[model samples]
Target: MPSRTEAKGVEAISSDGNLSTVHAQTSRKERPPVDSQDGWNGTLQQSEAMAPVYDWGPEIQGIILSSCNYASFLVPIPTGYIAGIFGAKYLVGVNLLLSSVLALLIPLAADAGVLSITVLRIAQGIAQVMVFTSQFSLWVKWAPPLEKNQLINIAISGHLMGSFITLLIGGFLCQTKVWPSIFYIFGGIGCAYSFLWFLLVYDDPIHHQFISAGEKEYIVCSLAQQGCSPGWSLPIKAMIKSLPLWGILVFHFTEFWIFNILVAYLPTYINSVLQANFRDSGILSALLLGAACIGTILGGLLVDFLHSRKIFRLVTIRKLSTAIGVLVPSVVFVSLHWVRFSFSASMGLLALSSVTSTFCQTGALVNILDIAPRYTSFLQGLSEVFAYSSGAISSTVAGFLISQDSEFGWRNVFLIAVSINMSGLVFYLIFGQAKVQDWATEQMFTQL
Candidate 1:
């Protein structure tokens, strides 16, 4: 796999759209509220000073714009469960290919109609979830407990780095005067990556034609007691009843609420708060993600170091990581507006928040593997259902508050974030267990 994996959301693209506004007035044909049979040239007016040429007000505009998250909200558990049953190889590869193709076709879809683009994005969302749903399943066969933090962190860091580079490059691409170049570049990369995925990666190392025997032996031996593979049956009721699982699920919801606002609206937030230009907004966004990428790797290493040395229980380390990640960011966020008096101070503060928040990768994010390696993939899928839902609503919530209360808008958003984090932290501290659940590994349990 490439060191960086590209994951672009429609909301991200929409939020990052043309930062420069037209000061010049022109006699132009305004687009319909919802495009139907609009030509590609008509879809985006290169001269239109504001965002997308679509004339829909923010209300109903939510339909086509947000279709991806709504669709993504529907399929995670089933996709995750299926990936657990079948090997992750085809699931990950085929879906990535499908998503890339959809991405390339999005411009054409926009030309067709608002409905056309909405349908395509919905399909892309479903396909991308299949790719995401397969990730933990791959780790089940490949990663040992001791190596779990570093390995998973390294693999997922690709997501962070990809977004960092994408923001930087996307900003540069915006300057090229070719509006569609970003889509073409990333879509092409996704296609190439998918092809390479099929050629080089496998569900398990043992299945790979090119793997050395010693490496396979090491992986299998390391995972022996931990039960490296998944089974056919699932204890759904037990999972529902588990408080620790709920801890992570709640954590996922709140975490998504907090961080997604950054991903989806950071450029706008920077533009509004700091009065920065698009290029400046892009640079700061990239810097935030770069910090997160570095911090994820370092946080993983720190976690493993403490656990390996017996300085604390793995569970204790997880708690500490979660606490710092949530609390520090909450503090900074509460003061988000006050600090904006200085651009350098604000950027420094945001970078700090981003770095600390990646510790969740070492904390609640990895706790699924700890408590239920057998059900990690399926559970992850289930967790992300909550995650994507919160992520989906987060932007709407922020946009609404911002629009309605211009003076207190961002402050309200930050306070809401702080409030959610504090509550989630309490729940997780009380119930977030690191040991494998009894139902996850028991052999005498009746199959449902």
Candidate 2:
């Protein structure tokens, strides 16, 4: 079973494998993906499963799958600086090319035994970050404002789908001794995506000739209302000082910590602790992720509905979601200590906890865009940094805690996760608000 970090940044379709809210600058020579028919608009028009090009056969598909996992590890480290300084186009281009190159190296690295499994994992992690970040950045550039939520959901769903397919089908493939075929398949797909991406994708809508004038007008108007500039640098200080940014960071950190622990380690926990079979573990893992997929879409719809009705502000909606979402799972974690049930019953409790907690994950992701539309990508990257960092910590700590037990003992780990979830909820309620920052407002006024 892959760790949560392997599934990191699996939620949103932002350039960083997380949610980022930023405006894309455009030039006539460089059109953004949103503007092209094959961009976000085109993608969302189809089913979420087939939205991204994840169907390039088993080997390449597995590479893309692993790449998705790998990117979750790599995105946060370099995404913010790259997007902030170089702009989204170069960021996307460099990342796409780099990820493909590095991914192809995995086979060679393995055959030569030049690196340990851990080091090879790290390399895959780096490639995952680059590829997803680039893909997300391009999506942000091309996707229209009104469709942002749905499009982002679809984009992120690709990862969920990937995980689901891998678990369900990967085992069979491996049983057939075609395991290496997975990586080879993904490598070939990566090369193909690079070629098509270079030819079809642009930096912004204004530069794309294929986009009609009416479509551009609709996009511009929608973005304006969402606090985005069509093609300008963001007010860096305002974004830096925003309270919502910090709120999002904390929220995402907590959500990812729980998610990472479960997704990465749950299989082992079930097998080692509950003494479940491999098939059972795989099924439970898929259910956990499937719950997350459902939670993400439902959470988005709920938040969007609330925002539309003006019943609560976006920030308040996010807070409410986080509180309810985190609170439920924290209670479940505590209950786990008392439950003397069969393994199936335990799995039921865990799956329920996962489904509810996932609401917080989607909420925090959408909030990144809500709070800082101008620098959504960079801010999200910042949040990813913290989220993934927590994931690394959780991974190491969970391993240590579980190892200390002679038998199936995960009580300490659950207690720790419960504490983290509760703390995140409290922090969010106390400090998180969706309104634009005072400094950002001032900066906007000054610019005007």
Candidate 3:
């Protein structure tokens, strides 16, 4: 199975607007026929090199693939507003449906050439941004205070799992005669899940058809105490002026820079530097992400446990986890260059970096709920604009930085990533907020 890292790399290609080099190969020599009397298989195998059929070159490929990330810069903010006004269930459902359809159409788009595929990827990016905005919007209505980190962390961890499953399975599938099956299988699964989501999930507990009466009442009463209610305007002016909000944006942006570098290029690093074959590269990449999944779950549990016991104040815990999660990884990432001669050791360090770094899922990610549960979705959306934008830049930037494919080029990329990660941590440590903002409640509006 391909690793989650490889899956993430693939997603980076699709979502972040990076072009994977498609080698255009010459026709393969015909294979010797198997003898019918020898009990050999009779089926003719398709050559793996026959796929990737187009070689648009780096320049054209980058322009086309990057449409997804560039289009993302326009979608999340508006989608968040739409989700807030119209409710998230339908928005999420529609986004899923669109993404699924786009996935299924990739082969056809590729056949039609670069422009067609680029347009399709742009549409998919639009759908993806809406999906994230709407999902976080749903959290505004659904997550209870005590369980906030746990719920959000678990939900986010599912992304890790999805990445893991896709990369692993896709790796094996890519080596098969039917490489296109990777898209068909995953897209079909997404379509099926969308149907289930529509049927089983509700916008809020109040409207849920199957939620127990007691549980619904408990949820309503809990939210009421925290001044969570519909009809609150999205405090646009306040959000713009808030230092803490900007802190979150910085945190998100810097964090994703490192993330983009890894997801988009880790497999390439393993292949080019470590000299691992395609299959091994995929497996090693998956192991790194699998470590991240573990870290996510453990980090969430640690936060919730500390919160429950009041072992540390909420702000303290958030900051501490962010430091531990982010800083260690930055250090490990820099140190990776020194150990390049030992492939197994380098892989181990990479996995450790991923594991420790994922604790941020429980830190700043859930911090949105802490400070502005009412506008968690909007806040997350706003931050994601910066994050995805940085993600896009990182891909382009990495391409330029590593153009030489030398150790010097790769080292510079890691150093830049490390520097960004540390800077974000410092910024957030100084300015990050955990207290619920006054603007989240009715009193602030009354004053307005």
- RMSD, one per candidate, in order: 6.5, 13.6, 6.3
Off by over 4 Å in 3: 1-46, 53-66, 446-448
User: What's each prediction's TM-score?
Assistant: 0.87, 0.73, 0.87
Task: For each candidate in the order shown, give its overall lDDT on alpha carbons.
Answer: 0.71, 0.53, 0.68
Clash list (residue pairs), candidate 1: 22-49
1-448 per-residue lDDT for model 2 (tens digits): 0111122123111111110000000001122223222333332333223212112221221232223343364566466546544555555555555555554555455444423423554554665555455444443455554455555665576666555544444323322233344445555555676565556555566676576777677765665665554223456565566666776777777777777666555545554456543334445565666776776666656666676778986666677777778888888777775673576677778878866775674466666555555555666667777676676667656656655673444788788887887777777777777655554442564331
Q: How would you encode candidate 1's per-residue C-alpha lDDT over 328-377 as one tens digit per residue?
A: 99989998789877988888889989999999889997799999888888
> What TM-score would you give candidate 1 relative to the actual structure?
0.87
Evaluate candidate 2 by giving its C-alpha RMSD to the native, one decimal. 13.6
Task: Tell me, by lDDT, which candidate is best.
Answer: 1
Q: Per-residue lDDT for 327 in model 2?
A: 82
Question: How many steric overlaps are in each model, in order?
Answer: 1, 25, 3
